[model samples]
Target: MNTMVWKVDKYVDNLENNPQVVDAANFLRKNEVVALPTETVYGLGGNAESDEAVAKIYVAKGRPGDNPLIIHIAEREQLKQFAAEVPALAETLMDAFWPGPLTIIFKRKEGVLSEKATAGLATVAVRMPDHPVALALLKSCGLPIAAPSANSSGKPSPTKAEHVLDDLNGKIAGVLDGGVTGVGVESTVVDCTEMIPVILRPGGVTKEQLEAVVGEVREDAALTDEAAQPKAPGMKYRHYAPNAPLFMVSGTAGFLQRLVEEKRSEGLRVGLLTTEENVSGYDADLVLACGRRGELETVAAALYDTLRRFNQENVDIIFSEIFPNTGVGHAIMNRLQKAAGNKLISE
Candidate 1:
């Protein structure tokens, strides 16, 4: 199928006055897929209640059946329609961070959401997106929308609509051009189904922020082969990868410089994603500095875009410096390590 692309200037602005959202809504109601931007990442969306529409998302992205999808809603009140019970804590967290980058996993409302939407799991991940275009689309459709990052599975998630066209061009129904995604990463996925909240995937919402709201929040242990059966999105899989091999730079700046030197000495074509402070001393064919230390939000916005840049440049490998594991940095590192494929911790 030929994927139609609609370029909406200032997406939120256009959404306020444009009638195209109504057409998009009608298309979704008929079980079609639409690529829309979010604060975190562009999403390939479908009617969450339609098994056929949800199945199309899996087929479009080649996502695994076991990896669940997140349902996007227009408002907090809509949460009750899909979730069997929204725990008081979950409600509090939602009130604190909804219309932003936080996903809460709650017991499914059974028939309200399709089994395909939740990967047949009893718990469903849901969030009210902060992006106006996304919310407008949902409100127009008046149904829960099941969506995953709008990129082919295992590739870096697209933060821009053009990236969606590059990866999912002919595979989807249409693309809503909403410019660049603000957060440029996925949502922080917290499973409230458990007695104590567990972070299934880290993104724009940090563990610290969640804990600030609910006292204590925990991250799942590092993924294992058996653990790849994701109870929520991005939990258990080789996701957010670029075409080129990616490596994480651990230890001090001097140590990272030596490591890059060694790789370059081996005559390898390397791309570096490090802080601006570290880039001055590194010798690489391509170097993309996210930002200076403590400026993780900048890094988050450029993360996927940098990966796509390296992939386009045909680099053999990418070496990225690790960020301090706090705030958005945690989510950035989560995506970087997954892209790197293996962990290299320095003592």
Candidate 2:
């Protein structure tokens, strides 16, 4: 099928008042897929209550049916229509961080939301996006939108409209351009349906931030080799990867340097993504200096763009430094490891 790409101007200041957004929302109401920008990332959106619209999202991205999508709403009031029961803890957390980068899972109301949107699961992940374009689209449509990152399954999530066009250009109906996403990562997903809050995915909102709201939040168990099914989006798959082979560098700086040298000495064109300080003394064909060692937020923001750049350069192999395990770093490293696919531990 030939995809239709709409190049809407970036909605920067007043999204709620944008006429282009109203048109995008109307398009979604008609059971069509629209790529809309969000604070976390761009999402391929469809009406959550419409099975036909939700199915279009799955087909557009080639996403697996078992991997559920996140639903975006304009306000907290919309939650009542979808959730069967909203816990007290969820309410407290919502008061503190609603209209932001946090998604809460709750028991779904039978007839209110389409089961296809949740991949036949009884639970639904929902959030109120902070981006002006997202909120504007939701408000104008007057319905909850089920969406996932605007890219093909197992590929890098799109932070800019161009990335969406690259992956979904001919696959979707239209794209409402908002400038680059500020958070530049997916939303933090917490399962409030459980007795103790379980974090299904770490993203724009950190574990520390969730802990402060819910008092005690635990990370979901790692996917077992035997049971590799993903409970949420971006889990249980080799996602956010570029075309070239990627490696996550671990251990000392010397070890990374040696690995790069070894790969280069083998006559392979290597690409290195590391801090500005680590860029020196590397003989790699392409080197992308991200930022300071501890400043992982920068790396998180630049990850996909850097990978896309390497792919454009036609590098044989890509070596990315492992980010420190904290805040957004955890999520960044998670994606890096998955992109690497096979692990190669250097002695």
Please give the RMSD to the true structure for each candidate, in Å.
Answer: 2.2, 2.2
lDDT per residue for candidate 1 within 1-347, as digits (tens), equals 98887776553565744676777777899999999989999999999989999999999999888778899999778877878998988888887998899888898777888898887888888888888888888888888999999999999899898999999989999998878889889998888887789887888988888888889887776532434455554565687888888878677767776777778889888788876776787778888877566678988998888889898888887777888777888888778778877655472
Candidate 2 residues 1-347, lDDT tens each? 45445445554666655778777878898999999988888999999999999999999999888888899999888888989999998898889888899999999988888788998888989999887678878988898999999998888888888888888887888988877887777888989997888888778888888887678888777532315445665576788887878888777777877888898899998898887777785668898886567677877777777777787899998887777778888777777777788454654
Error of 2 at 45 (Å): 0.5
TM-score of each: 0.93, 0.93
lDDT for residue 136 in candidate 1, whole number 0-100: 80
**Runs in model 1 with CA error above 4 Å?**
11-17, 223-233, 345-347
How many residue pairs collide in each prediction? Answer: 1, 1
